[model samples]
Structure formats: structure tokens, C-alpha cells
Target: MSEGKTGAPHEGPFLLSQLVEWIDREHRNEPGRIIGNLLDALRRSPYYGPLVAAAEKTHRSPTERLRALPLLDRDTFYRHSPPLSNDILTGPMADAYVYASGGTTGQPKFALYSNEEYKIATDVLGFIYSTAGLEAEDVVGNIFLAGNLWTSFNVAGRALENIGCLNMPIGGATSYDMMIKFLQAFNANALVGLPSVIIKLAEEVERSGSNVRIRKILYGGEHLRAPTVEFLRRTLGCELVRSAGYACVDTGPIGYQCTHLGGSLHHVLEGYQFVEIVNPETGAVRNDGEPGEIVSTNLTRLLMPVVRYKTGDLGRWVEMDECACGFSGKTFELLGRCDDLLVIGGINLLPSDVASGLALLPVSQNFQVVARTKNSRDLLVLRLEASRPLSDAQVLEGLEHGSYKLAKAIKDGWLNVEIEWLAPGGLPRSVRTGKIKTVLDERHG
Candidate 1:
């Protein structure tokens, strides 16, 4: 057992704030010590204690012990540790900060963090913001949605405070004209919000002929498409565009993209998080460059131990030494979520694959896939958000040439595909998180 600052044996309710300091001071590169300390803390939890004890009995090594534990999906996690319940907490909830999950996949559930834990998470996020090129002198406009127990705006505000940057919490609900007015008034050079929102703001800025030149954009909530990134760059005169960070309310901060890496690549927060890539179908561990589901274990969260928690996202490990960012640690490339996979005519398809098929189109990234059954046959309707009408023949040609599986399925009469065009922002979005539902399976309806 490790001793606290008072030289007493630290037992019961480990302070993650103190662990942050310990990792920074002595065990920066020691993965064994880090995992051991985290496992020690987890051993004291009511929900995890019995599981950890059993794993320890069978496995002599810490890695094996961790692997022996059960993996938690969202349903399993909530079933054992229901929202706002004290079943999984190692400490009291009086001093904790609570936030709700986006409920994009299911019902919204609450996640708690002690004051110290929140501080550590925000501090690390602030460090990542700095690594992404935010400076103390930059004026940043935060347009992330707030209120309703959401975490984005609150967390973004706190992280900006740690950076000592001039932050304007304009929020996403504010009108585009008002947001632009505030950005111009404050002389803001940087803005943070959802990719969809940012694109709309850029379009509005161009329409109004504003002189505001946003040099940096930090986006989250959804993936930014290549065409949309180019649009933002061309309209806003942006020099830097990157994801705020990869995180969720349940798991907190997981990974961040350094200045050296762009696109979907992210460096795992090795000090604060333990990440594993496992085969999505078989639950077996995957080697580097092999795509699989992402499972995470948060080392700093003792209030509610998240051990081998399945993130529902797919990714593959990248060679860490290949990046010259100086930090030698685990890195991975995100491949969207497992739930985004759609089954059409007994064939598996990903929304990302469909997007790639339509990459040459002038349409925006805001597209929806509606799967329905007509006369006992699977029918797929691709609703694309476009500024102008698109040629059906051209769009079909692109999709057919993009994927062999899709082409074969369509040609062999196994599936039927159709195209629907909608005005930009016509598709429905989740009221809670403001993200579009990519796949809508209406066969049962």
C-alpha cells in the first residue's frame, strides 16, 4: 500500500488528485506501477472488490488479473451501477459533480466525479488544449451546448480557465448572428463547438460578409468530414482544425490528438487511462494495426470504478514511436462506433463506408440511412443533405464503385437502394446532444 502525504497508509477512498501528482513525479514511464496502484484502489470498491479478488486468485500478474475481469457494456454497467445509485461508489456522493450521458445510444444516465477527480480531468484536458496550439493570449469562443446536466460546455469552460485563455461561453443555443457578433466584439481568434454547428457558423459568416477571421476551430460531438473541413478552411480562413478531445461523460477524458497527429489518430492518456483494443466479435485482444473494439479502464476514477469498460467504439493501435511528439505512449486510430454498423439484406455495412462512397458528391456530411422493408425485401434510402439537386445516376455510380460488397448486393437483387435529397439541416437531430442519428432501422415500424 502507498502512503499519503501524511506518511499514513492510504486506504479507503483513494484521492485521484494525489495519484496524478505521484504519476508525474515518479512513475511517468512505469506502466506496472500505475496499473498496480489503480487495481489496489479498485480492490476497495464494493462492486469491484469481489471481481478483483477472484481475478487475483487466478492470475499472478496484474495484467492477467485485469484481463480476467468482466467487460462492461453500457447496459451491464447501468444494470449493476444504476444511475444516481451508490452501489458502485467507493466514496460518498456529497462532494461529487454529476452529469448525464448523451443518451444517444440509450436512456440518459448520470455519471459522478469527485471534486478532485473533476479538477484532474479538466487540468489534463487543458494541457491537451495547449498541446493543440491554444495560447494564453488567444481569445476562445465556447459555443458548446450547455444546461440539462450536459458536460460539454461546463467541462470546456473549466479547461479554458486552466489554460488562462480569454473564454467566451456563448453556448450553442445562441443564434448564429449573435454568436458572430460576440466573436467579433471579443476579437476571438478561436472557436469550439460541434462540427455541424461550426460549419453553419462559417456559412453564416460568409453570407454576412463579416471581417471576422477565426484562425482555430476545436470541434467535438461528431466526426468532421473531409469536405466539411475544407469548407471551414476556405470560408473561415482557419489554420488549425482539430477535435477538442475524445471523451464521454461516463469515462471522462480518454485520448487527445497532439500537434503532430491529425485526422482520427489520438494518443491515449496513458497516465490517467488504460486502453485496450479487442476483437469486437470474439473479445480477443488484437495486435497493433488490427482494428477492434475499444475497452477502457480509468485509473483516476475511484468513486465509480470503470474496469475493462467497453466504449462501443472501434479503433486500431498505431505505432507510438512513429510520432515525433516526444511523448512515447500508446496511440490509436478511431474507426467510428460499433453501433453505427447496419445490416442490410444480410450484409454488414458501416455509415462511414457509405460516406466514403459518396465522398465525391457536392453534398454535405449530414446524411441519414433509412432501412425499411418493402414487400418483404430490404430497401435502403440514403437521405443526403445537399444545397442543390444531385443526379441519381451519378450518385449511384459513385456508391457502386466505392464498395464491392455493396455493388454485389445491389446487383444480385439481394438489396434495393434509393436516394433522397433534403435541404441542409433538414434531418432530425437528438434534442439532448444535437447529433444526427446516422442509421434509422424502420423495418419493425
Candidate 2:
């Protein structure tokens, strides 16, 4: 089925949409039935008993009644919930596979997936790759970190295998030299990994003056910025750089990019999950295209079903006409995470936005944003790691009139940006993730 020319949801020929419909057909539009079932299931679990009882107090139909249920944050669901076991599972949990989320620190919470959930996850990835221009004979490199409870590499590898592509499971931790050797030796044509990791690898390729055979790349695990996109295009000689999809260990298969605009938008998995954008301050639902916090409810994940779970990411619903690439579902544009947002002089700033603004100027690939409180006032430090220091005249000239325009122009004078020039290796890397800490918030200390 094809989507309508209007913004209404339409049937599509993609396997992922079909699988979603097959798994939970009724829950796609009329989520009340699933909400009722979820309530009934939650009543049987000690951890969710209070939540269910609270919902039961409302003397309304389960569908209409559940809408008033209080939102559940990570602290309530993972930290404060009563001891949980198989009681949360809608079905038997004997065959379920457990995976933990890659939280920055502290105790990691576990998410359970049944046999069918696993299959659906990989199937979604396969559909995403096929949609993002993956060919059958493509040699794919799975550079996402694996082991230590990480799921991206294994999940991506299975997807590549499912689509009958030649894939090498070279985890993200692999050294630059070894990764390059593997890519060259195996003739990798496509790569999938975190954007930061991919950029580091590309930097190595450029430094070594080697011509790698890779052309296509798909980035996930974090926000993909325009500057990074330009860097990849220049260093890796990539033409097709798209988002692998929007997903996490907590919520599987959020959405994927269609071929229409590449990574500008993502086709929300309408049949599989309910996505909502709510005002961060007031908690009111925002209209289509209004920026707000992204809240997701998983329709297919029966085991440990997440209802109105706060994803902590910022994004908004968008209505599009029939996509030229063929998928007929509504789409969402992902803004950066809520926690990563910086408030400078009453203005909200995203690291990705800063990077994109800098992409307009003549800057290097290496840059970082440091937020600090000076004299009880918020200050933003923009660190640019140029090969050599630029003269005051050059910096002033670029800031005034550049291709993308300067950061101050983009900020509209709500905030002032202080530029700091750094040599290579000037910025520090995160000890845990081995990636650059692009946004450093020092005001919280």
C-alpha cells in the first residue's frame, strides 16, 4: 500500500512496516486496546501495581482513561520500581533475551526482549539498510561497539546478514590502523557506526593519504551534524551518508531515514510505536512541527512494555506529502537530547547547531563547545582546532560573511560566542566512551 498525498498514514511495501502491522495490527491507531491489556498485565506485577491502581481510580474507559495516567520517567521505572521479574512480561519470559542500556555511569538497567522482538529488531535494521541504499553484494563494516552489554554491532551485523550482505563485525573499539587494514583488506563499501567514531576513522584515512573503497556510511548512537556530514564527505569520499535509524537499547527501532532527503527526516514507525512531542516545561502536547521532548510508547515490546516512557530526546512531528522515495508514513526531525541543551542568556543552544553554524565558516573538523559559569553568568566557549592559528583579520572576515554564516548570526545576539583556537589534540576525550566530549557543561559543578 502507498501513502496518501495528504499527511495521513498510508500502507507501504516495506517489510518493516508489514512486520509491525502483523505483530500488532489493532494497536497502530486504536492504542486503547493495547493500553487496556497493558494495564491488566501491569496489575499482575508488584512493581507496577501502584501505577495500575492509580490508573484504575479514573472511572473512564481504558483507552480514554489511560491518557491521564502520569508520565513515567527513568527514576520511577528503573530505580524506584519494586523488584521486577517475569511479572512484567506479557508472555512467558523463559525464552527472552536480556540487554542492558549503555548508560554513561551508575547501575545500568536491563531491557527484556522476546524471541519475536529480537527478530523484529533485526528485520527493522535490514529494512533500514535496504532503504538507505545498501546493496546485496555490499561489504558492510559493523564498527559499532559490541560486548559489555552493547547491542548496536551485534544488531547491525545480524541485519546485514539477514539482507545477504557481506559484513565484518569489527567493533568500535578496534584501533584506527587495524580498522583501516580490515576495511582495505575486505574492500568494505559501506560502514555503520557512531558519527564520532566514524569521523575519527575518516581522519586517520585522510592523514595516512590512503584511498579507501568505502562510499556509503550510516551514523547512529548520537546526533549527526552538518559539519560532520561535510567532513565525512571530504575525508571518506562518501556520497550516501544517512542515518542508520533512530533507536536505542531502551526503545528498539524508533525510526529510519527514507532516501528522499537522506538524513533530514525520519519515517516514524507508526505501526510499531506511538511517538508524541510534549512541552518540556508544561508537559502539554505540542502541535506538529513544534519542538518538544520526545515521548515514546512501544506497542510491540510486550515484555517490559514501555508506556509513555520519556526518551529524554528532543524532536517534533512533521507532516509531509507523499515522499519521493516511496514510504508513506509521518516523519519526525530529531533535535539533540534535552540534557545536552545549553541555556546561554535565556537562549537554548544545541551543540549540533553550533557545529552546523561553524560549518559555514572556514573551520577544521575538530571543534568543541564548553559551557561555563563565569561571575555567575553563563558563558559559551567555542574551541576550534585548526591546523594553524588564523589571523585576527581572517577570523573577523569569515565571521562577517561566510558560506553558512557565523555563530553569532545564527544565535541572533541572544548569546555571545567566544572563539578559542586550538591545535590538534587540544581537546580531551571522554574516558568511558573514547569519543570527544563535544559539549562540556561546567555550570552544574
Candidate 3:
């Protein structure tokens, strides 16, 4: 457990005074031994004391220090040739888990992280549990995917157990019927699963007759559509805590979610590290609301110091607004990977933005923005998931309506691509991994 006691940042930009108050209150009850250990770690980190102390020397608040930090992209991490300056991780090179995100590679890339880095990331995940109202007495029903050596299921399950909470790891791999039986038989109260999968479960319960009494649901690896939250709340009788968890074999788990207007994921644990969001080209910090690449400096890493390490993710800071969750931090949403972009009529587009818009429509369950090239021209295609199939005329009319709105929003005629709506479970699903790749670019041009 971290010696420092802290809680979630309230939604939106944090005032300096508010940040200080939260900082003081959070650490008030913490044991001195924990603080000493953390301080010792910081002291050992050549970069940590200097960076944070400089901010303090300038009389800057935590937020101000964060603002001074820069963002990074996938290219930068590779160019830097190292994630961190300090060797925070330990293990033979062949033993670490390498997870990649993006780079010169045309696909979502991956890299490896030392085993110790994975442990540290998992250690901090308990903070997410506390935010979601997980108690020691609550037996958590984990529905996150399993099968691959991927870390979500194992890391999360271990974290919950580390906190001394009993966990029921029955989900994702099992069918909906088997999952429900596990949940009911165990009398589980807390639920953690992929956002979309849980919503599908909610729909099954709504259509069929099954009594489920869940108190809280903590999920990630899937974007939480507004309707999914409503469905989970209404059907399962639970408060849905949707979070964007950041963990890579290379970078380790870092960010979590803040249910606020500012953004979806707040890099709250940054006090333990430095977080940045930079323009991919200029390498300069992006202005608030303009998305850019994300980077970080993990403080606990010794064998590997992730200093200015690019995460290949892009997002923007929340402009002047208090979050509904009342956490004060520089929160931002995960826009998508740098490679998850599609070019339409010579314009750059993100699948995440389109998905966010479609999320406003309850029928559009899951979607993929598939782009192909023919005769040196980019063709945009959309594959959407729905509960039922639409007739040709109905599809045409729906496309007309959606295109008009999308064209106006994206300001490009080609932004509204061809829409192919399929019935539920029609879309390709990643059964082993939690994340479903909705945007696919198959253009060799």
C-alpha cells in the first residue's frame, strides 16, 4: 500500500487552493512509515525531487506543475530510446511483458514492461476500487476478459485480493448464463467487466426475466456509452463506475476515470509520477481542449524510469468547468490511438469522435470505422452494431439523416461514410483481450 493517502480528484480544472486542501486532507491520516518509504523512493529518483521541488520552489501548486509538463506521442518514446531514465524495473529482458501502442507501425503497437513495473501498476488500482465503493466485505464479480497473457484479468484480480477483498473471477470467458449463475450464487455485490459486455448482459436481463441486485460496477477497456450506463443502472440496480484504465506491459497501469464533465480518465496518480500530453509533430504541449499524445514519468520505476514516455494515446484537457464528480484535477478523455485515425478526403478523423457521437444513439451498440484505398482515394466505411437489422429503404433514410448531422459536425462531406448496420453480435469481438478495435485502416496507399 502507498504510504500517501489520497482520493479521486473532483471533476474539472483544479484550483490551486483546492488542490492544496485535497493534498493535505488526503495525507493527514497516513502513517509516517508509508510517507518515509515514498519519500525515500522519490529521493532515490534523481529526476523526481528535482522536478517536483522546482515546482514547489516556484510556489506552484500541483496543477501548475502538471500544466508545466509536456505531452508525448508513440514516436517520441521510441526516439527517446527509453521509457524512463531510472531502471525502475527488474528482470531479464526476455522475461518482461512487451506491450506496444503505436509508432511508425501501421497497427496499434505494443512493448514489454518488467515484472516489477506490472506489480506497481496493479498496486495502485485499488484506488479505483475505493472510488467505486468496493468494501472488504463485498465479493467482486470480475467479468473482464481472460485467455491471453494480457494483464487486465490477472492484474485486477490480484489488486482486489491484495486489498483483502474476496473476488469472484467468473466472466467474459463464460457465457452470459454461466456468468449470471456465478454472480447470483456467490451473492456478489461489486462488478467489474468490459463496459459493452456488461451492457449486453443488462439487455439480456431486461429482455429475459432475471433478478440481479448489484451495488456498483467498475469497468474499463470499452468506451461507456451514456445509454449503457442508464441500462446498467435501470436493469441491474447498480451505480455504474466506468473508468479508462491505463496499463501496458511496457508502461504499466497509470490512469483511471473521473465521472466528470472535464473528461473520462483523470491521471490522478500523477503525484507518484509526471504526466504529459504533447503534439505529435511539434512536440509542444497542446492547448486545452485540443487533443494530443500522452506521456508520463512513473516515479516508482527503478529498473525502468518512464520519463517523458509516449503512450500513443491522444486527448485534451478539460476547459474551465467543475466535474460532476467534484474531483479537482486536469482530467482528459482518451480520444484513441494515434494509429486509430482515418483520413477522409485529405482530412484526419478519429474513430473515437464518431463513436462518441453514435453513442448518443441507443441503437448503435458497437461500431468500426474501416478505411480502404482505391485509385489513391481514401474510402471511409462504417460498420455499426444494433439490436435489429434495417431494411434497405430504412437504412438509406437513416444514412441520410446521420450523414447530414456528421458532415455538419466534422465539416467534411466524406466524414459521413457508408454505414453498414448489423444485428447484435454481428461485429467482430475480441474475446481474449478487453479492447475491441473499431477503426481499421487497410490502405496500402
Candidate 4:
């Protein structure tokens, strides 16, 4: 998949056209039928059959039966079927494309997709790239990390090809200087990669005063906050910046951002995937505009049917009217991870909230919130890799002024707040995927 002409063998335009027609006919107008068919198919899988049978006994409707089934978390997913095993596969492994999750939070897990399924996934991505303003004439630089069983470089490279754009398969490991030279040499107008890598490249470009004028940036693998977006605009001289799309290796393409959406908002891939926002504590479905953990079911993935899988990420549905981009499907806003939540001195703190508090500061977007214990007291440390030297008073003032909950927690002495500054590249990143660990709890350690 990584080599020449990335995606499935069929012509890119034909596949994209077919997918668009399918989305309109089945996904948008008759989603219930799609879910119903998916449920019927899962009932035959050895792993999901008993669970579906149990849920079917009580619930008459497809949605009700799906809601009744247990949510599959990461631990539970691997427990039932370990990596590289056929325990969870509904079909044989022949002619299947295997990819592995980055394993940033845990050990890496592998997923299989039959050739037809792979085509569908990439074609959906190609459609999303078009929505994000990627043009067929544009030369795109693909800097997403490759190898180590990672899927981004391969999948994204393939998707770009499906868009009929000229793709420079420059993996993320290349030196920033070399990458810039390659972009210039290729006259690349758009670049796609992890947010951290893009930021680092932008910083280097700013430092070197490079004249590489990339017109668009499509990022994935991590959330790109507003400050970072602005930084990229200022540094790279890019007119358009948006998420490449919302997806994970385990679940495939889930949601996508169009030109109309910004700041964690994405339109669900209605026909390809079903999304649900559920209460983190109770697992009950959340109403639109209410925050909850994101639960997803991939409608097209029959090889390793991902049904009602807990994504561990937090988000909420955005009430839909007609979008400016003409996508009438469901939309949602992504919050931080459920696992990144920190309870300090009886106050619940989320990494997204912390990032919001520090958003206005001059610090770089890459920062970490470390929760620890000091003298039997809960301490929260904000570790920032400084763009320039900053005072403790300045950071505290920003945090207190920006977030109301954090302000109250500090005022009442429920939390002890400290600031730690480091030079660029001081913070640790996940070895496998090269993404920042947003929150770390050393309270128990």
C-alpha cells in the first residue's frame, strides 16, 4: 500500500464516484438500513454472535439492540482477541491488508482489512480530502510517520493518490531542512502529517526564514488547537489549515472536517461509520451538545467488525442544520481523552480545559499537564516547552483568567499549581507515533 499508486487497483475517480453515490443513497437517506444490515452480518461472526444474540432477545429495534450490547474498550478488545490472531476476524485473512495502531497509550494492536474494504476506506478519505480543498493539480507532501506497522503514511499517501494529486511520499522521519528542500523542489502546495511534526517544521522554517509557501495543511493523529493553527498560518504563510480527518487504525475512517468546520468539529462519515456520545460514568447515550465519550461502529468493516467500540476520546454532538459545505449529516465536537481526565483535590480536570486555560499564552501548543502529590496535597504542574522565556506570574494569570473552574480551584486552595518551563523538544513524545502525551498522572507513582 505504501509503494506506487497507493490505494486499490481500480481507477481513483471511479471509486470516489461510487462512494459518493453510495453515501447519498444509503448513508444519508437510509442509515437505519445500513445499521440493520451491519447487525445482521455481525450476528454471524463467532466473537460478536453471542453478544448480538443476547442484545436481540430484549430489544426489538436495531438501535436498541446495539445500545444494549456492551461497549468494547481497548483492554476488552485485546483480551477477547489478541494481536495477529483470528479470534475476532469474521472472515479469513487472505488478501487482507494489515495495519497496526501507534500504541501510544498501550501495546500496539493490529487490524485487518480485505482489499475491497481497504479501497472503501481510502476512497472515503479521498472524498474528505476534496472537501478540505485539496485539488487534483496540487502537489502534496506526505510527512505522516511510516513503517513500524503504522497506517497513517500508507493510508494517507493512498488517499491523496485517490484524489489524483501528485504525492511526495516524504515520511515524517526526514530532517526538517531536507523536508523543506523537498517541498521547494517539488513545489508542494500542501503538507499533511502529525500536528507536532508540522509545528516543528514550521518553527524550523521560521527560524531559517525559508520562503516555502505551503498553501494548505491537513493534520491528523492529534488535535490542533487554535493557537497552533494561528502559529502555522503566521509561520507557513498558509491560507487554509484543517484536520486531515478523524480516524484511528483500529476503527478506520470515522469523521472528517470540511472547509466549514473548525476547532475540533467534524462531520460523521454517516454511511461508513456510526457515532454515539455516551456518558463516561454510566455509558448512557448523551443528547446533542452534551459532552460524553465517543463510541463508534464501522459499518463497512466486516472483516473485523468494530461494533460499539469505545474510542476513549471525548466529544459531543453538534446540533445539525444544513452545513455551508452541503454536508447534512451529523456533526460532533471533540474534547480530550477520557483517560486524560485528572481528579485533583475533588475537582475534575480535563486536559482540554487546561489547554484552553493556556491557549492565550505565548507558549507553544505542545504542553503537558502533570498531576502529582506533594506533602499529601494534590499538585498540578503545567509543563510548557517555551517559545521564549516567560515568567511564572504571567502563566498563572493566564490560567486563572482563562478557565473559571481552574480559577476557583486555585482560589480555594483545592489545588497547588506550578509552572515548569523547558526548551524546545524537551518534552517526551510517544516512541511509536511521535505524538505528545497530553496528560500524565504521577500521583500514584
TM-score, one value per model: 0.87, 0.83, 0.69, 0.91
Per-residue error (Å), model 4, residue 426: 1.9
Error of 1 at 88 (Å): 1.1
Each model's lDDT: 0.79, 0.71, 0.59, 0.83
lDDT of 2 by residue, 1-445 (tens): 2221222122223343454445345544666776677667666665566776877786577755555666667776675322344444455556767776635555666777776677667777777777777877899899987776667888898778756778888988899889999999988999999876787788778879887857899888877777778878888888899999888777787888867765557887765666778988888878758888887877667667777778888888788887886656678888877877777656566776566555656556556788887666667777876666776455545544432334454356544457788765566654444456567788788
lDDT of 4 by residue, 251-344 (tens): 8888988898888899998878878999989888888678899999998788778888889888998988989978887899887788777888
Q: For candidate 3, which ten residues in a row score worst on lDDT?
A: 8-17
Candidates in order: C-alpha RMSD to true structure: 4.8, 5.5, 7.6, 3.4
Per-residue lDDT for 1-445 in model 1, tens only? 1223531112322233443454444336576766787788777677788888999988988778888998878776776564535567776677878888736756788788887778767766776677777888999999998998898899899778766789999999899999999999989999888876787788678879998899998887787755567777888999999878888888888888879878888988776788899998888888768889999988778887788888988889987674686667789988777767778976888776677677666666678898989889999999987678689888877778777788788889988988998887787778888778788888876
Judged by lDDT, which candidate is best? Answer: 4
Best by TM-score: 4
Q: Write down the worst ten-residue block by lDDT for model 2.
A: 1-10
Residue 2, candidate 2: Cα error in Å is 24
> For residues 1-445, could you state the per-residue lDDT of candidate 3 as single tens digits?
3223333332322333343354335444442333344434544444455654665566444445534443434454444333442333232355455554342224443455556555545556655555445667888888877754555677788667655677998867688877788888878877887766787677666766888678778876655645456656777898655563654544665566644422255644544455667887878877667888876656455443455677767767655455565655556667767767666665566554464455445554566778886566556677777776555445444444544544543355444346678786677765446455767878763
Q: Give the better candidate number (1 or 3) by TM-score.
A: 1
Error (Å) of candidate 4 at residue 366 is 1.1
